[model samples]
Target: MFGFSIQKLLFTVAVIAAVWYGFKWVGRMKKVREREARERLRRQAGNGGGGGTGESGESGAGGSVSGVAEEMVECPACGAFVAATGAKSCGKEECPFLG
Candidate 1:
């Protein structure tokens, strides 16, 4: 009877340990996913801001302007040339840019 009780206790301990380890593993995975998500967001933010400089003196410092004539696109509403990636209406209330 004592040996049977010992076996039951061991089985209970094993099951508890397995559950604890599973929880720990899940928590660790969640932390890793959160860290990876944060890294992706940081990379996206950096890319969105357009970092670095060109071979010439231009550092691409202008807001929303790529400074490259080839990359510029004309806005149909206001006929204003803006960065192709950022081309939009002139943002004038009287212009179609507002919509």
Candidate 2:
């Protein structure tokens, strides 16, 4: 014969709560990942569709197209990577990118 006790009831409630919270956490994480993936795809699409040219048949340098991944170079002075296109001085005397 099974007899229900207060301890058993409390334990069951705790287990249910744990499972509910776990499910909610998983769902929230899944939604966050999905949203991030969508954002990445949107950025990629907006970035000239991976082509260096835009609808006007001009290169990305013309400013007509954007989202192109630029080459990054390490700053000799700061050792931090920066966009190579318009690299600027890091205010260090030895910075090679200094203009």
Candidate 3:
């Protein structure tokens, strides 16, 4: 009878552990879903409610018909491509795009 009681106690403990871990897993999944939703909302907000086109004067995968694409200049300091719209530098204080 004592051995049987020990078995029942262990089973109850195992079930409690399972429930705790299950709740933790569910909480992690909920956090991941919330983060993804927030990321999507931030991206949509940054798009400025445009028709997903070049209406905002930004170049995209599809060619823009409203305006000519601004030429991308190679930053001599960092060798990074940046727009040539009065950009004296690539916004990097350490390495300004002099060239």
Winning model by lDDT? 2
Q: Which ten residues in a row have the lowest lDDT in candidate 1?
A: 49-58
Please provide, for model 3 over 1-99, each residue's C-alpha lDDT reduced to its tens digit, 9 standing for 90 to 100.
999999999999999999999999999999999999997885776675456564443345586443444677877767887788766665666666553
Model 3 residue 90 distance off true place after TM-score fit, in angstroms: 43
Q: How do all the candidates rank in terms of lDDT, highest first?
A: 2, 3, 1
Task: For each candidate in turn, give its C-alpha RMSD to the true structure in angstroms.
Answer: 9.5, 8.4, 7.1
| Backbone-clash count (model 3) | 0
Which pairs of residues collide in candidate 1? none
Predictions in order: lDDT:
0.69, 0.79, 0.74
- Give me the overall lDDT of model 2: 0.79
How high is each candidate's TM-score? 0.50, 0.45, 0.48
Over 4 Å off, model 2:
1-4, 49-99
* True-vs-predicted CA distance for residue 28, candidate 1, Å: 0.6
State residue 31's C-alpha deviation in candidate 2, in Å.
0.6
Candidate 2 TM-score, C-alpha based? 0.45
